[model samples]
Target: MQLQQWAEQAASQQDWSTALQLIELAAWQEPDNPQILCRWGDWLAAAGQPEEAIAAYQAVLEFQPGCPQSIAAWAAVLNEQGQFAEAIALLDQASEQTADLWHQRAVALQSLGDWPQALTSCDSALQLDPTAAESQFLRSKLRLGLGDWSQGSPEYESRLLVFSELRDRLPSFGCPLWQGEDLTNKTLLIWGEQGYGDQIQFVRYLSVLHDRWPETPLLLLVSEPLVDLFRQLAIANLQVATQFTFETESAYDFHLPLLSLPERLGATADVIPLAQGYLPRSLQSEIRLQANPRQLQVGFVWQAGETSDRRYQWRQASKSVPLEQFLQLRLQVNHCQFWSLQVGPARQSLLQNWDWADCDLADRMHSFADTAAVLNQMDLLITVDTAIAHLAGALEIPTWLLLPKFADWRWSLTGSETPWYQSMRLYRQAIAGDWRSVFEQLQQDLNSRPY
Candidate 1:
């Protein structure tokens, strides 16, 4: 094979060193080749060198203006870096619009919170290629965000087919999937298939399922850490387990993902079942935090945990806040004790800033049950978009959830109140990647609280 072909093969196999060496030689051999330059730019971007990627794209376009492939690639990187309008302008400069260019434009528009324009662009993409999985999935998220659950819920199934780092890690059952039909003589196995927050949020559907199909055996299999927290649901005719053996597959007539319950149950935003006080109230945990009668206890989680796990590549973006922001909030208050429940990257900074000795409860937390015990005693929980937010909400604890400009679909498009958690209020970023406004709102809200 040619040098360029060898570089492409190495890049596909994730051998960055081999790929870089081969691509460098190939670029040296064919100095004017736009294809090689664009591919090299993509590789650079993937390898976390966006500036170099942009330079490589600039080289290709400088040599050959209106190069569609190079323009699209460069625009994508620009949009990912929060340059929405610039990305769009670059895409507009293209002589002809391909599906990729339209998709890139749609993404940029979506980032700008122009959902209507983004939907239009996405429709244009779907028109060009009716079977595009990525666009279809994006459409689902857009529709759901707009509260059009009927269309979005059905299209959301496209996620299972998409190529994500989390896709292959999801559990697959040999039996057929349940489709909201009669299960008179059948057993349905509901497995938690996503993050801890997802499992916590969706577990509310168990009681509803049991209530509907009184005789049908419903088994819920969640992660081991959650078994203690979820078993307290104590719903009638419900069985909660942490494991599923191959032999058990023979017993289950059908299997369904926990998140899929929404679609199967036809749950719209307006009519969310078991929205509050659904998950076991106060979650009977053996652990509890020590609280002073005179001081208001506050627990906070600044970052999502276990981000290095390849399955949660999405969390690597860091929805966390700077430690200074929380400290600033701390300065404005008096007699309100702050406990850092933050895990992952922010844990070290929190320990250095505060005496971990005072917040030994955070260190002792190992399971969702342990976190629940801390949250149970907390007067209020201030957190980013993490599983801890869901856990606190599950316990009906007062929580202020700070969200990014484009948060997940569960929070919906625009609302202070969420249907999923009555005690939780959302504080979304008005400007993308800017948390200043969010913190300002938080300060006002916290100051008004009667401590």
Candidate 2:
């Protein structure tokens, strides 16, 4: 078997020792082979040996100079290690060596928050390959960040081709593109995309469409995670459907992605629906005991997901704050009740710092519904860009959404508010993974609030 295939199998089976051995053998057999070297670097990086990966990639330049893959991979490692300047330099070199290299360079620059430079790259990328899905997707992201929705909206459609598997599963073997025209009296099927927060952000467009075309039949094709929450809307002629039962007939006249609504509605910050207190319901007495009213009821969520079984999985999980950060904030804010809205058990130990006086709601709530019941009484939700923020936004409750600097396009970079949720406020890190500023801002914002 080829070393690459063997290594892939080893990694798949979590036989990292075998994978490492195979990569080393491959590297020795072809020391000057850039592809082999780059693969070794990938394995090293995936194994949490980024420093070694950087060396492996750097060695590739000795034989095959200006190799884009090597340059891009090395730059990525550098970026991960916070060496943004070095990473940008490498990406720039790679871009100049090839046509449309600016796209990769632009992404590197975007990671560094150089939007103007990123824009220049996007222009170059579009010039070289206007039809390229990635270039268009990145352009859309940069445009959204630049507050240029007119251009970004169309670019967002690039995802349909970029993630072809998702497109393949759709009724049509293409993105459910819409012109954002009238849908009154017509049954419009809208499906969610990407993450839960995405669904929440996009659903705001539903309310907008419904109001504009009150006569339209809105059939929302939602995920199992959100059916119960969306069912609460139950607007006349509005139906929530999950699980594609083939027996169910195709019933909609038009369709669009949940994320596409912003483009359709021409949403900007000034026109956002910013209402307050979305999910208004009292919890049972037993549930109520889990929250303390004297302390400002603050809900916390850290960590995103743990799907990958590799060294990098640890880093993906690190997107959340260590438990001490939450504990410190709970104490610093003073007179605040702390509760966890986190979904998984892997990081529950982080709450050990909080006194028993603070309730740990992580285990008590079974799903979003149980969590929503607790959130209904919350004074505030301080969470990363996860589903709970979406839930809070959907209910029109006051929520502070902490976003990574490159944030989802739906948030739009120019504002403290999102058009999707009137009561939702945004706290963005100045740089990706830099949460200190966001936390500081959250503390200040909470202090200024009436609640």
Candidate 3:
């Protein structure tokens, strides 16, 4: 009992190491106690030791079968580990359903690409507790993922209410959210959100907003890195701002996040505007590189950028393929010259061997535009779901995007194509964490491609 109390105190202070140690000792002392075992599982999961957490949960289920709390916690970890089907089976073992259990079932089903069933489960959860913001946010994603713009768009606002980071970072403006208010004699300031890829993907809405309300001045705020790339949008009334925040209330009449425009713009999967791409024809900045005519020019990015958000790290890792796997594709494919477009700390993987890439462009790329200039010189760009992938697709370059089995909603369930970019083709992993098959298929496609 004292050890459990000490563990709870340590956990509250975010001392996961001490908490885990204390919790493990407490569980060992009271080996038959289901409460202590469940607490140990929770601490293990919080410590990022998922497999150990599963074992702890399994120990609880061994004696106290059909425990709802243990089953829900176990399923949540399974979902995080990309074991969606197993999570669903485990959820069914619960003696009784709670809002949390229903929510876990929906999460597992959603990960398995069963949007309809997932939505039903989400509705059940919401019925149990309408105030469950996480369930509401997930339902919003499911609705939008199914291309239901009308219902999903309104529910999407829950993101602001639910996600603490997003809510905190949202620039506090005195102006109300623009929504669908008339644009005549008004100004709208739209800011970026999420990651570089999200900002790039959603910036197209600015072009739509500009054309719809050309008389109204539009301000687009983004991180400094994307300022040059977005300028290529070429809207007369649009001004891209690099500033982090707004100082005065008078910058614009109404302010909204760039993503908020999709609802007003009436865009769904059936009607993603500028699918051919909105970025201008290759800027004169395009380099005319001289290379061997016998070989095909190929650029590859094997990893996505890192994030401190522990909850999203698994998704981020799912989007990345090991550099060695891509390098091995070079040996199987014929007459294709490969270059590395990977940057950030993961770029260090290239230094492991000199023969991996013909050229590493990490140092040469200073901005998104610089990457575009390089893409202009490439015959094809193959990459994971990164900002570079979005940039390449936006530039209307021939791009092959490698995706995990459980890809982002934008990529949809299973297909070689997406509505977002006509020039981009998708190659998805048939199973989670299996890049070998993806690369094997890619190699065959490359070998069979007519020169």
Which candidate leads the pack in TM-score? Answer: 1
Rank ordering of all candidates by lDDT, starting from the highest: 3, 1, 2
* Model 1 / residue 6 / CA error / Å: 2.4
Best candidate according to lDDT: 3
By summed lDDT, the worst window of 10 consecutive residues in model 2 runs over 309-318
What are the lDDT scores of the predictions, listed in order? 0.79, 0.69, 0.84
Pick the winner on TM-score between candidates 1 and 3.
1
Q: How high a TM-score does candidate 2 get?
A: 0.80
lDDT tens per residue, model 3, 115-160: 8999999999999989998899899989887878788888888888
Tell me the lDDT of model 2 at 412.
56
**TM-score, model 3 to reference:** 0.87
Ranked by TM-score from best down, the candidates are 1, 3, 2
- The lDDT, on a scale of 0 to 1, for candidate 3 is 0.84
Better structure of 1 and 3 per lDDT: 3
Candidate 1, superposed: residue stretches over 4 Å from native: 165-172, 243-250, 305-318, 354-357
